[model samples]
Target: MRSVSIPDAVRCKVAAEPRVDAPHHPITLSFTDGVLTMEGELADLAAKKLALERAASVPGVDHIVDRLRVAPARTMGDAEIRDHVRDLLLEEPVLQPLARATPSLEPGVPLRPDVVLGTIGLSVARGVVTLDGIVPSLAHKRLAGALAWWVPGVRDVVNGLEVVPPEEDDDGEISDAVRLVLEKDPLVDASQLGVSTRRAVVTLSGVVRCGVERRAAERDAWCVFGVDGVTNHIEVRE
Candidate 1:
C-alpha cells in the first residue's frame, strides 16, 4: 500500500479541529504494510489521560505510538485557571463559529483538513490564534489566512502552517498562438513566463530579460485576454 505524507499545509486544519486537539499534542499518523500508527503528547497527567481516551476513539488506527510523558499533577488552584481559560475560549463567538464550521467543513482543497477553526486554541486575551499542522499549497495558506480574518473577534492570526508545494505538472501546455507570440518576442524570456486565467482575467508572471521584455509579455498576454488587463509581475533579470 502506498503511503501519503501529510503536507505542512494540512497542519492548519488539524490545529483548528476540536476533535484532534483533545489535549493530545503532536499527533502523528502513519500507515504502512496494512498497519497504522498514531502518536500523541500532552503537557500533563490530566491531558495525557484525556488524550489516551481520545486516541482510543480514532478509527482506522492500528497502532499507538505512545510518547506522552506524565507531568506533575496539577493542584486545584491550577485546575481553576484551566477552567477559566477554557471558559474564555468557549464564550468567544468567533471562535465558536470556527469550532462549529470546522467539524463539518470538507477535508482538503478549497480548505485543508489541518486548519483548526475552533476557539479552544485561540488566545482571546492576547488576540492571537495559535495554529498548527500543514497546508497543501500557498493558495490554501492564503485561504486559511482569509478565513481567520473573517472571524468576528479575531484581531490577528498567528499562522503556523507549513507550506507544502503542490506536485509539478510538467505536461502542461499553452495555446499555440500564445506560445508563438512569446517565443518570437526578443524582449521576453518565454522560459520563465507563466499564464493563468481566473474568470477570464489572465495573469502572467516570470522573469523577463529586461524591462522591455516584461512590457512585451504584458502586451502578448493582453492579446489573449482581449482588452482585459493582465497582472504582469515579470521581474527584470540581469
Candidate 2:
C-alpha cells in the first residue's frame, strides 16, 4: 500500500477557486493510504452541481467524497441580482460607449462631443441612447445596453446595432492594404493580395497560405492607422 500527502500549495489553489463570497460548505481533502476525500456545502444549486466538476479539474486528486449540498435560493430579490449585474456590465470597455450615448438616445441624436468615445458613434436623447451602426457580435450589443444604464441620466438603451458579417469588399481592401504594407517594408511579397483602406479601417482578403503570411498582412494593416486597428479576414490555403 502507498501513502499520499497533500501539498499546502495545492490546497491553497483549491480554496482560491471558489471565492469566499461564494456559498461554501465544509470541504475536506485527504490523501492518506492512497485515497482522497472531498466534502463541502456549496452556496447554491449551481455550485453544488459544479463541485464535482471542479474537483475533477484539479490535477492530482485521485478520488473524491462529494457530500456537498446545494443551498436553496437566497432571499435576495431579482432586482438585487440585476443591480449587481448592471454594475459589472458597466465596468467593461465595450459598454462604456453606451453610457456615453445614453443621454441622447432620442430627439434627433445629441452628437457625441468626445472623439475617443465618438469613434464608436454614441448618441443620446432625453435620457436613452439609440445605438446605430454594426456590432461584431451579440455580446457587444449587451455591453452597449449595460453602459447606457450605467450613465447618471440614462433611463434605457435603444439597441439598433446591426450584426453584419465583415464585408467581402472589406476583405479586398484589407488584402490590398496589406500588399501596400509589404511593398513599403521590402520584406514581403506585396503582389499576393489587393488591399485598400477607408476611414482608417484596413481590410484584407485573398489567399495567404501560412500563418506567418497572414500575420504579416495583418501587421501591415495595423501600421497605417496605429490607433484605428485592423480587420484580417484573409483566407489561408495551400
Candidate 3:
C-alpha cells in the first residue's frame, strides 16, 4: 500500500478545531500514511473523545492514535468528587428537571431538595462515578451520564439509568432496536453479534476484535430507548 503524506492544509484544519485548539487543550499532532496521532493531556474523557472525533473529521485522515491523557484540573478526594458531581447535575438545565422532581410529601411538609436529588443515586470510588435511577427519557439518562463525565476528578462513569418512556416497549421491539444500532455503528460488526431482549433487559453474545469494540457495542445497546439493562457477554478475540 502506498503511504499518503500529510498535507499542511489538513494539519492546519485539525489544529484549528475548537476541541483541540491550544491554550486549553494544547495537543501535539502528527501524521504519517493517513494516520493521525494525537498526544496531549486533557481534563477528561469527553475532551479526549471530542479531540479524536475532530481529528478524524479532517479529510485524508484514515485512522487516529489517541494518546491523550486525562489530567483533572486538580486532584480531589472521592467525597469531593461526589459533591462536585451532585452540584453539576443540579445546575445542568437538561437534568435540573429530574433533579428537582418533587417527591410525594405529606401535607404541609416542606420539600427537601436533597431527598429529591438523592433519587439519582450517586456513588464514587477512586474517581469512578456510578449513577443509578429511573429517568423519564433516554435523553435525560444520557445527559446525566455526560454531565457526570464533565465533573473534575471523574475518571470514568457508569450510567445505570433506567428509561421509563411514556409507552412501554416489547421485547421484540427492543431487540430490533439494539440490532439496528449495532448495524449502524461503524466500529461494530453486527453480523458477528447476537442481540436479544427480555423484559427490557438486553443480552449481547458474540466475538469482537478488541475490548474497545466490545464496549462500543454495549454503548450502542444502551443508546436504544426502553433498554432497562445490558448484559454484555461478547468475547474479545484479541
Candidates arranged by lDDT, highest first: 3, 2, 1
**What overall lDDT goes with each candidate model?**
0.44, 0.47, 0.69
lDDT of 1 by residue, 25-127 (tens): 6766555543445445434333333444444444544454444443223322322332333344344443344343344334443422223444323223233
Q: Largest lDDT belongs to which candidate?
A: 3
How well does candidate 2 match the true structure, expressed as C-alpha RMSD?
17.8
List, residue by residue over 136-233, the lDDT tens digit for candidate 3: 86556656775665565766667777777654447886787678667756788999999999877789999999999998888677545456567899
TM-scores for the candidates: 0.25, 0.25, 0.38
lDDT of 1 at 37: 51
**Candidate 2 TM-score, C-alpha based:** 0.25
Misplaced by over 4 Å in model 1 are: 1-177, 225-227
For lDDT, candidate 2 versus 3, the one ahead is 3
Candidate 1: deviation at residue 235, Å?
A: 1.1
